[model samples]
Target: MGRSFKIALAQIQPALGDLERNLSLHEKLCEEAIAEGADLLVFPELSLTGYFLKDLVPSVALTPESPALTPLKELSRRIAMTIGFIEEAPGHFFHNAALFLEGGEVRHLHRKVYLPTYGIFDEQRYLAEGDRVRAFETSFGRMAILLCEDMWHPSAAYIAAVDGAEFFLVPSASPGRGTPQKGIFANAKAWELINRAYAQLFTVYIIYANRIGYEDGACFWGGSEVIGPSGECLAKAEYLHDSLLLAVIDSSEIRRARTMNPMLRDEKLDLTLRELQKIQERRS
Candidate 1:
């Protein structure tokens, strides 16, 4: 059963602090993606609101009760949409959450586990790390999400594989440099290697979306890719200010790659956790 399912990854240049405009842009692109025969579409991190809003985060952050999610529910009926935004809950804690929308409703929400605080990243100051990782069943296949820094961690990807996710969808908005060509192309190649390694090692498909343009003195590089279970570059978007990456996935490839290189089967989680604790103790 080598059935193909198409996915469109949106490389959007989201306007900072403008929730309405960003949501509108996403809806428009979602329509375009669906028109092109895509079964699903993925957007970058905080696309509804810019990544770094400084002190304005509290005002820009929207809860599910904010009426913003109503339109998104309508859009999901056309095509399955996965977009990242700030989730504010009862505890006054915020999470970098990705909503999985299908059939005009949000099926599930996957929060970001690995929040980066190094370099230009001040995510730890703004949000809390999420501990739950869930794999969702869809019309296409089983899928999981790894938002931004979560992709940098092998453990997150490992958990998704162990949970029986056939594919991993990543939504990221990384900084960009002055020179467009050098900055964007360089980042894309590095992410490609990283994503391909995880996909091949776990024998799962990796669908990635990276945003473009400048936000709060940081520029985002947008060169998205769709890597197959065998580490093949199935489809890729050019390193431009904004573009869309599209690909059709064959679910059977997962089993085929596993038969060749069974990395997950050989994994020992109990031993892995012990080693992690030892490494932490050494640092302490």
Candidate 2:
């Protein structure tokens, strides 16, 4: 009876380089999520500028005071929100960060720790990746945020789990990175499984919101999914379909899963660190 929260994933199709239009679309989605009684509204990675904006980064880089985000902050009064975008901070470095808004003003901003440089994702070319991982408290419980490729790495979730995060949210523009013949278990499927594996191992709610539509030659899978504490796929949106995926997270599930499995308590961190150090030694 501790707490249970309803969350909504706004799997949107954003137009590249159109700040005003994208912001308006997010505003509408936020209204819908709030109306549906969702405690958290999750948007995709680089949602403000849209994915496939490799060429638009320099031209559309925005300061925090930029007009694009003003309306989103206003929309945050009703429900808590997490929107991803390029953060033009000090120096020429732009961070792929997520903005968490509650009670209207910006509450916290979590930057993407792992930027994908390989394949079609040139995030490393445009963004300076965040270096640390820590959990942040919210109106809902202790929560953590990871963007795109960050979720694929164990550190993002492991550090947060150690830091006492009860829930984790991942914003992504992860698309179908293969031909249609491959099907089913593509990049989207791999991430879904990875998110589920992390959620089950940590006994935390994992919320993944991915984008849809084709940007240039890249095609977003749009199969945003939610994994419960027991590693169950609570809900998954249709692939390539831009829609809202909602999941009800019951915090009690965390206790129940841990009590039943007892894996969290059995973690041997010092030993794990020794093994990791040995691996590093081998690499060096």
Candidate 3:
């Protein structure tokens, strides 16, 4: 028998700068996921604070030990979770972070490494960028976490895959933009292509949970989905609507995919590292 686990994607809207209300929504979604027997539940990036937080970022920032997050810690005892929030780090720095809460403890904390400052995104102005990326062990196996904008860089995914991550949990708050392509927003379609490419190239499961709602006249298209190691779209939530999607993942499938592809087994990490070192020296 292959190892398998069920996951729930909570694709809901967060109240702008309203931590109390968003915490309530998280609790509600957690209860639903538990009722459905899901082993893991994922929420979108900044799930506790809506996107477009210009100056309100500091107001909603919370540490991992904040009393406001106590309920989520309690809920983690029943089911594992990946939830995003504004993290108040040391030295008065704030980060766009996600926590893997399991068994009433913070299993892993991933601060978003890439902070987008172009277009409508101004995260760098208010949040400090994370400097690390590594996969962590979990009951389901090795997993990695990447927030919005971080997925746009292929290096992050490559590092996680090489580090033995079997699955990537992506939390995003992307706004819908550009003309419609394939009956969906261009950004959404672009994300689909990227997620599929990463899953197929790395031969790992991509569990993407994006939010849906209007903030500051921008609409977040929630096309949350789960892609298998074979680049197959297993389960997808509705676009521009609140939805809870469920998908079951099997490790045997990952093994079979890697065996057939063998890309990871053939990677030249040392050669890449040497070249990277040379480039860094030249830049210096």
Best by lDDT: 3
lDDT of 2 by residue, 215-276 (tens): 88778888888988889999999988889888887888888988997776888889888999
TM-score of 1: 0.91
Q: What is every candidate's alpha-carbon RMSD to the true fold?
A: 2.4, 2.0, 0.9
Write out the backbone clash pairs for model 2.
Answer: none
The residue ranges of model 3 lying beyond 4 angstroms of the native Cα positions read none
Segments of candidate 1 deviating more than 4 angstroms: 177-187, 270-284
Model 1: worst 10 consecutive residues (lDDT sum): 176-185
lDDT string for model 3 (1-284, tens) is 34988999999999999999999999999999999999999999999998888899899999999999899999999999999999999997999999999999999999999999988889999999999999999999999998889899999999999999999999999999987856898888999999999999999999999999999899999999999999999999999989989998888999999999999999999999999999999999
lDDT of 1 by residue, 1-284 (tens): 65788889999998888999998999899889988999899999888997887676777777765698888888889899898888887797788888889998778788899988977788888888898888888777888989978989887888898888888989998775335464444555678789889888888998889888887666687788899999998988876568877888778888788889888788887898899999999999
TM-score of 2: 0.92
Q: lDDT, candidate 3, residue 144?
A: 98
lDDT of 2 at 217: 73
TM-score of every candidate? 0.91, 0.92, 0.98
Stretches off by above 4 angstroms in model 2 are: 63-67, 182-185, 274-284
Among all candidates shown, the one with the greatest TM-score? 3
